[model samples]
Target: MIRAVAFDVGETLVRDDRYWTSWADWLGAPRHTVAALVGAVVAQGRDNADALKLIRPGIDIATQYAAREAAGRGEYLDESDLYEDVRPALAALYAQGVRVVIAGNQTARAGELLRALDLPADVIATSGEWGTAKPSAEFFARVVDAAQTEPGETLYVGDHPANDIVPARSAGLRTAHLRRGPWGYLWADTAEAAAADWRIDSLHDLTQIVSGAG
Candidate 1:
């Protein structure tokens, strides 16, 4: 039985529109161009950060993150960035006596913003806070540890199969491949994503999944 549900932040609970838009605006490039490049990079199975490299070669992203903040254009998150299904679905899961978690490949600032939103969750963590990122066994182990549940009973959900489903499943956590973002729609039917214990298009679908598990 599924005892806990952990989610990926970007493009799973968050839509990522502002994320790409900020990068495009900062670089003085058209939004569509950058988005297309992002899709291309994901399609090629390269790191999503490769999209930024495709725009400006040899760019140091970490340095630029600091630069953006100094220029008053750093990472931002608010309720507006959340998807429609996020609050209601997470709350519902919480009310059903299931542990809800928000664990994703995000910076510490993003985690702070998420906490400020006060989403219904037992634990909210980020790769920056954990000092490890997904596609790593250690990260998912932390997720299971945070959930206070065994690996098999912890359900990790995310849009990126490579960062979400593949590694979580390898760590023995049941995975839900969310077909919500570019990487999600692009690779939903791939063999890697197909190995997920479940595939869902919306967070609302998880209520049924959890009930059925019981």
Candidate 2:
């Protein structure tokens, strides 16, 4: 039985369309262009940050991020940014006394933004806080530590096959691949993605997996 459920923030609980659109606008690129780059990068099993570097090369990313936050433009995600299925599923799991952790590769302001959006989770953490990002053993270890459960009893749900499913499984956590976001949809039929304990179309499917209803 799974004792803890860890969710990836962007594209898993919250739809990041607005976030990416805003970033593209700020980067002086067309939103659709950024979107296509994102799809292409992930379809090749590459990291999103790599796509950003390829698109906006030679820019001081950390300084740019700092400037964005200082100018109050960084907090882009809103309550409505969440997928419709997220709340109900999280609430159901919370009601069942399962630990819910939001662990994602987000910026320093991610927790504040999440609180502002009122996303529910027993613990909210980011790769920045843990000093390691996903696809790294250290990152998943931190998530398991935050969940306070054995790796085998923790279920990691995310939209990225490479960043989420593969790494989580490698770290001994059960994996759920949600086929909605760029990486998720593009890699849905891949062998690595197929290895997920649950291949779901939405967060609503999680209730069944957690409760053993399927």
How many clashes does each candidate structure show, in the order listed? Answer: 0, 0
- Model 1 over residues 103-181: C-alpha lDDT tens digits? 9999998999899999999999999999999889999989999999999989999999889998998899998999988
Best by lDDT: 1
Off by over 4 Å in 2: none
Candidate 1, residue 4: CA error in Å? 0.5
Candidate 2: tens digits of C-alpha lDDT, residues 88-202: 8999889888899998998768766786766668888888777888889999999999999999999999988888999999999999999987777777998988999989997
Provide the overall lDDT of each model, using Cα atoms, as 2-decimal numbers. Answer: 0.92, 0.85
User: For each candidate, what TM-score against the reference?
Assistant: 0.97, 0.93
